[model samples]
Target chain A: MTEKSPGLFGRLKAGLGRTRAKLGGSLATLIVGRKAIDAELIEELEALLLGADIGIEATGVLIGDLESRLSRNALRDGDAVYAALREGMLGILQGGETTLELPSRGKPNLIMLVGVNGAGKTTTAGKLARQLQDQGRSVMLAAADTFRAAAVEQLQSWGERNRIPVIAQHSGADPAAVVFDAMSAAAARGLDVVIADTSGRLHTQGNLMAELTKIARVARKADPEAPAECLLVLDAGVGQNGLAQAEQFGQAVGLTGVVLTKLDGTARGGVIFAIRKKLDLPVKYIGVGESIDDLRPFDPEAFVDALLSGEA
Target chain B: MFTGLSERLAESFKKLQGRGLLSEENIQQALRDVRVALLEADVALPVVRQFLEQVKERALGREVVKSLTPDQAFIKIVNDELVALMGGQSEGLNLTGDSPSVVLVAGLQGAGKTTTVGKLARWLMQTQGLRVMLSSGDIYRPAAIEQLRLLAEQVGAGFYQADTGSSPVAIAQAAVEAAQRNQADVLLFDSAGRLHVDDAMMGEIKQLHAVLKPTETLFVVDSMTGQDAANTAKAFDVALPLSGVVLTKMDGDARGGAALSVRQITGKPIKFFGTGEKLDALEVFHPDRIVSRILGMGDVVSLVEKVERTVDHEQAEKLARKVKRGKGFDLDDFRQQIGMLNSMGGLGSMMKMLPGMPNVGAEASAAGAREMRRIEAIINSMTAAERHKPEIIKGSRKRRIASGSGTQVQDVNRLLKQFIQMQKMMKKAGKRGGMAGLMRGMGGKLPPGARF
Candidate 1:
């Protein structure tokens, strides 16, 4: 979207400015003029990681790993400690494969975008459509979010901008019915990918949770293995509550991956590690900006570098 | 979700209770729990660290009171700190400007900036009796302008139209000029937001601020953003002179890091809270009440305020007189109470504002709403004779009512049970201290199985 998109690392660094300012800046101040990793240093570092919205479980694991490494004399200095922290972050984030494996030909890759209200589910779906379209893949978008008054229009605007076909019905229509029609259309038209936009409902809403299950069930009717990727688009700004959403949404619709959005905003993006460590779901994409090109594949190394390179 | 911090703090205090003296080790352990509580609430890590340092300084070496336990004393100290950290009192809008006073709203994309603009406009018009003008400078998004225009029309505010063709600065300038021409009391500028904080977005907003020089620059942020809300508010504060913040979607399940940290981090008061998606769901931010709310202390003041706004005094007085006369509270009375609760944002929100009821989540609130609707439906299916005298409605009548209400017979039965329980409670109230006793009892506990 710029004259030329910045390299992944550069964009990542810029994308994580706020978080880096919070973590990297604090870490630098904490370790300044420090000769060794002492109890006080470890305590400060632990506070920093926990503060970044990294789950207590993930932070505990990282701290435990760091402490054991320190006890073994592997972590001697601040530099080693910083490296160890990076490695610890990567360890939690690196499990799932980053690449979204497309299914073999004959059936379209149906990616269902779901998350709680105001998590940018529709926007992420649009940008994803553009990302796939840029890859020379024919994409169709399903405006299945009939709950919000503006959701359908928002998705349609994205479809129109990207010049992708959008399957939509009237507002307040059954979202499951809309998804069913979109899948049928995608299959009929021989589209390479079908991105479905679900209505943003709080994970706590039971009826809405049931509606999501119904949507997934309806998608299966169109194709036996429909909704190949039920990507949960989580707002990185969400705190411990992200864990609850991930658990509940995972149980309801079966999340395959996560698309962490608003990373460019105030969200520290630390919740990705929690989502990974807890749910075993790889963050398929990270939205860094409003543009289509801002959606970058999640690279654990790049993310850590961005998050820790504030002093640099 | 915001209750997580209070709940976690409560757990820590529970451990400290029955302790002989507050030793250094015990204090440090308690501080660690408090740090985690702040962090889990999405308070910025640095803010959490500094907050703990202050709390530790104030809490340590303090003499224990005769009556209160060390844990209670520590909690009281923490509660005081929480209130101070959030601006100790509500700072309202600066409306001292001449006609066409301007209020500029800014925030990240999907942070409910536009909706807050509409709600603020409606609030200004209805509550403050000011003619408000609304305009959107969010040119990048395809329907951003249209969305604000629709919102303005819905709220009956003066709309200043701007298209994507114009620059954000130009849009702000035009909106101000139009507001002057329309003789509007206040002009609200809704600026565009990028998905991330970028130079282009901030630069444009800063330029708009310079041009408009609005009286109030409120950062509209999603409360769901947790700690990021404070950080993002800080970012905008650096760009523009932010006077206050609007914490949107407080009705949602957010850990409330933003509400807790925004004032401390940015040194700006949270002006209002966007409780729901509806236009009228905005509430004035009360720091002490919010601190109390966060501490699992019900905001009785706010509840009373809401009651004053929603309840019909004449009808309430009539009901009170009937109850005082011991005429008995019936199904019709229960239906009216349920309707009143629904108007006051339902049982769930009411339950949330109540103290010692932190576990009543969105799911429970929604279930309560569903139950209320069912009861209302069943009551609607009842004859006027049956409503006045429940004794006449036999098993055959219950079956007919259930069918008419599209509910199972058991649902009607459950409603009857709930109604009977409420009737007994009302009778007890009438026999004792009357309305004051009923009001006091309402604050103590919610009956486990009663739906209405």
Candidate 2:
């Protein structure tokens, strides 16, 4: 445990340190320790988890699991404690490694991007478009976010750089009609892929959410398997709140994958663990920078290693 | 625990509370606590320093309220300063532009760009009665186009998609053409986002700007992104000409530092805020209301606005003039004041708007309902003539009024004593500056009373 190089797990270790320190005071002290597990320790641990913003429901399940482990006399020293905690975490984290796989055989695998405003949905879409293009696929972009004044202009700029087509509408035009036109064009042109950029909206807003559902329905109607994948982009810096957004948007539009953006920006990326554990949503991509190539496909072992190892 | 924050604040306020006189040392210590709290809440360091400097300037030599402790007076000053720092009034989107005005959404990846598009679209269509069209220019992710299409349909707006071979610029140009052809009033372009602000992305966005010059280029940033959000906004400001900002994820447990920082750093008014992921969760940003909330005070600006709308200021002034002339403050006038206060979110909420007031939960405050009713009863029991002249009520009248109002004699005596004391205090304070001074005094005392 050198002071300087705490490895890839430095931030996680540091976050855990602060959480533990905050937990060390008053009521929390009575709940967790190196000694035998007790009711006090369980209650305190529960409080500690909730205080860490791990959320209420997840905290309950984690406490229950810990208690069962304790009752089986599986309690041990600090390393064992850490191992048990990791095991509990892994139960939620391990199986969600599948990336957004492209359709095996289709005119162009249409990947529909979605999320709340500021969730980096646009950036992730651009990065994913660039990534797919890099992988030797003919990619087309549809600037379906016709609501914002310069959104289409910005997306058009991305299209020019990538030498791809971006279907767009005016600043205040019908977004659904634009997508319908873009998809029809993509199908007719025999394009290998079409990535549509949607406007940022709240998952709870009924009308906007209904609009998203309608877009999916329309895409499917155009080609029964038109939207091969629906990727929900999220900000890594959002912590637990991002997970809640994921849950809502996932419920509303049926997310096929997730893109965790801004990994290089913050240390509180433990949200990945929480999202993986709770929502069971696969991390399809990881956005590291502003460059088009910065987007990379999700690799669970690499991610866990990078996160746990604390490497840049 | 959240109580840690509140307790720390209370301790600071305690230092400024009841003192025969306030010392410079006490003020410094209290300011130090406030600084620590602000910093801990993730306020930008520079903003905190600037805020502290402004507060220190305003607080020096200010008279402490007569009834309040020194801490209470200091807290009032600090609260007012905080409200000013956050901007005096809440501001909403200025959609008062020409029809089909362009509102550009810009931000880094994970900044909630797409969601804001939908929110703004719905707001325009529902609130402004404009036809909206949504388009996406993110060709990188195949799903991005489809996502925008789905959102457009959900919002009851038109959508567009381009062939992979066609350029995004061409698609955007064509989309604008499409909107013109359809006669849609508002066109929203959910532009592509990058992870970091890069040259290529900037050049590309700049090129798009060359083609379609939008009316408002809004930089969408995540409030939960903290300092990074501010930095990103700066980066985007350099790359694009931003007209306003859209802050998202405000519903999170953010101490609201980013909101303050973004406005201060960019000099751009926050156009809208995304409270939740719901389309309607988007709200126009109002600086004054946000300022009040940050100071742990309910929105006083709105309260004052409500009062201005409901209460006749001329009538209140006339009543005050009569009381000053020793004409006797009457129950009817008091009743009218109570009615005005009730209309303005009740006395409890008004009190919470004052500085140093502990935030009483709704349930605990509701427990005081009986006390309010008792006070109302005591005032209602007096005859019109008796109500007009408090001096006419003798000991027998007090007993009769107490019995009539279903209370003991002590209750009536307490009310009269309070009224007389208030009258004397008002007279001593003088006419012109008296009410202002009273309001300032009330600002200090309300906080301590709120604890009960």
Q: Write the per-residue lDDT of candidate 1 for residues B227-273, one digit (tens) a residue.
A: 56655767787878989888887766667877767778788888899
Most accurate candidate by DockQ = 1
Q: Write the per-residue lDDT of candidate 2 for residues A44-100, one digit (tens) a residue.
A: 555444333344456567777877787787875433443465467556666754766
- Please name the candidate that would achieve the greatest lDDT relative to the true structure: 1
Per-model TM values vs. the true structure: 0.86, 0.48
Cα lDDT of model 1 by residue, A1-312, tens digit: 233223223447365433333344556666644576799988777666665677677889999999999899997788678878887887878866677777768778888989877788888888888888888889999998886656677888999999999999997899999888887888898888889999877776667889999999988888878778898888877777787788889989998888887765545667777777778888888877666787888877778766554321
DockQ of each: 0.38, 0.07
- Model 2 lDDT tens row, B387-414: 8788799889988899999998888877
Using TM-score as the measure, which candidate wins? 1
